[model samples]
Target: MVKLIHTLVDHSDDVNYCAFSSSCLASCSLDKTIRLYSLNNFIELPYSPLKGHTYAVHCCCFSPSGHILASCSTDGTTMLWDTHNGQTLAVLKQPHGSPVRVCRFSPDSTYLVSGAADGSIVLWNVQSLKLYRSGSVKDGSLVACAFSPNGNLFVTGSSCGDLTIWDDKMRCLYNEKAHDLGVTCCDFSSHTVSDGEQGSRYFRMASCGQDNQIKLWLISFVDFLGCELKYECTLNGHTAPVLACAFSYDGQMLVSGSVDKSIIIHDTKTRSILHTLTQHTRYVTTCAFAPDIPLLATGSMDKTVNIWQFDPKQHCTGSLLEDEPKMSVENWSEEEVSVWLCAQGLKDLVGIFKMHNIDGKELLSLTKHSLTNDLKIESLGLRTKVFRKIEELRIKVDSVSLGIPDEFLCPITRELMKEPVIAADGYSYEKEAMENWISKKRRSSPMTNLPLHSLVLIPNRTLKMAINRWLETQQKYNETT
Candidate 1:
């Protein structure tokens, strides 16, 4: 079933990288040029070669949706190209002050991440093709980068032989000394694999290095230690340094390209080689699997690109998540909870939580309390309507599912607060609602009826965060429900 369908030899020099979109193949080369080929006919597109870089183009990546292609070069520039007509969309000059080594698109296709010889990683917004953020992995150059399927995590491999996993906030979640030699390539699965022991489902990550091995990993939640990444297994069949690895759309097959000019396709479950492709005469540097197809693309230093196809369909079977995993709210900080609340547009809930010292984990108990007697919540004037809304949200009506948790609902207007603020008497209310209460209605506390000490409403940042976490949890359950 393994067959080379086409060989594209448009590059005048060594091809550094290659990628497969749904309709096209893109390759960058040491000729300081980028090229596109149509997968339908296996011929170069009418635009042919795109020339702009002053030095060798080191890497190129197609966004998940196949809308944009990103290329980085030794010219110290990264360019975004419109994949349709081969026009430059945007250009970033001297992002790293050295050769841009690699670039990748986030699983969601909303972000583009590029790594360079200067040890810097820059994230670009795909829509605007503008820089979103940038950071350094270490003093050593970043050679490879990947984003988890959930879009919550990413991993970068540095020349110093370390692999660092980071969260959406760019916080290092885990770091591993993966290989004795610099890691040459890394990729994430399109599907998640379950950690049979922890009963956890997580994306599988594979990294190949100068050590001639491919390492597999998964992010798992451990009981006392919180979230952790576990090393799963290793495959070692390549005779020389493995330069690239990619997971099939279904995540059942793992493909590795080596300096020995051989590509090994391993069954991920058995860690056994299923096929060995020796069609390239020089070191194979890059490879990619089309997200929903059987096609695989690989490039070599031999200045050629090969498109290989398998007979069997390689689409994801279904979701790997059987049960929604719980994120620990026991240690969630107040600020974190507040952020969630704000994101959910429920700032009014913060006051009630603070008035009662509510932790996000205590939501079940909070639900047990009815609207009639929940610690003087409804007594507040504007808050009465908010509590009413909470009562309505707790139940699934004839069609609508259970909405946000009752406690997170704003007390002033009986809706999710647009801007939550704390009034003087330690009760949370919508800032606008409170303003109306004091100015239009009366100059007294809605709940206490005491003269207003101060109208200053402190933002309930912690509650906002809790609201966000809660929403995410609910959404996850809804998917698997």
Candidate 2:
């Protein structure tokens, strides 16, 4: 586990962005070409090089499906490539006046969004091969834009300290001047909870800024006349400008990389520092957590990406022996037990199975009949029987159909399988698809290759009004049902 996995060194100059496919890493650099390196530890040089940008390639991203690669460059252009054939499918020319700093594909891989030094944000329809709409922020340069997990909303951070949220249709919903200095990064977290009654959905947003602060906002219900969005809390800690921030997949931890060359992990609830990772020798540029693994990756100006493995068992043991002395099961009161059970996503099991209430009652006698046979009654000596019963229950639960909506399904493969494989048209192409697409496109499109330019203007007020209306409609639907 502590081995050097891979070292991708094809970039002739400073690399700005590095993203992962299922089996490869795609990196963009000031050298203007995006390089794809195999994830295998043995592979050294890039498996393929995509060269098309007339200037430095600022950012490169893989679609959620991993079947498409979208790249933006200092040439003021964006290109879409067919991941399967290494073909340039489309070229977006001069989308902005200045260099495009960053570009990202929508969660569904149906759209592309780019931010530029010209203080403009452009949304493009991938399938239709058309520029949908462009909005001007009228501030400093646009740094980053991220679509929410639900794909229904997105947030853009600006160099002028503004953070704006927009709908999927490219309408600005919430506009706020969030910081005294430029905002560097932001992310959204959604969690499901059963608060004594029934399971409900909740979301929170985290943002970092050049003002040396990390702020958190709970997306809660608001009794308002115009908008239902409201800011909840601001978590301030970093001593230097924060460069990047991301939430764990489980929405329990928040990690922020800062210009101070440190990565800080904060508890999502308490908004308190859990760990301060200080290994990087230079400014930590970016950090991301594996979606399904207990691994954290940090990229730095030190020219290295450090991968940290999180050991939950060791973390629990250390917590139990901390100076403050964490409360154990033996010290739990009635209220604490309820909280623990709820926190484990077992709210329905609360009060139904109490150790104190069990006397001579048969294991299946006191509970709901439907769950009795499903339960595994065990003893210290009945190890074999207990394991068999546990396996049976797991199979039964796995077989149960929860009727999850298609929207909740992963867009990559349109399925609910664990560790989902990225697919397109019923085929699972290897990770090289994105790189192949970029390479093919560059060879075909010469006229579209140009450098980016910059400009500044105000965002459209009409688009903001439209987005506000859409949010209000969704809120009303949720409230009614």
TM-score of each: 0.63, 0.59
Q: State the TM-score for model 1.
A: 0.63
Worst 10 residues of 2 by lDDT: 445-454
Best by lDDT: 1
Report lDDT (CA) for all predictions.
Answer: 0.74, 0.60
**Candidate 1 lDDT over residue span 424-447, tens digit each:** 866777778888887785766664
The C-alpha stretches of model 1 lying farther than 4 A from their native spots are: 94-96, 221-227, 313-481
Question: What C-alpha lDDT, on a 0 to 100 scale, does residue 353 get in candidate 1?
Answer: 59
Q: Residue-wise lDDT of candidate 2 within 375-478, one digit each (tens)?
A: 33233333333333334323323333333333223332333322222222222222243235335653221111121121112233443454455556767877
Report how far off residue 323 is in candidate 2 (Å). 13
- Stretches off by above 4 angstroms in model 2 are 1-12, 40-46, 83-87, 190-201, 220-227, 312-481
Candidate 2's TM-score reads 0.59
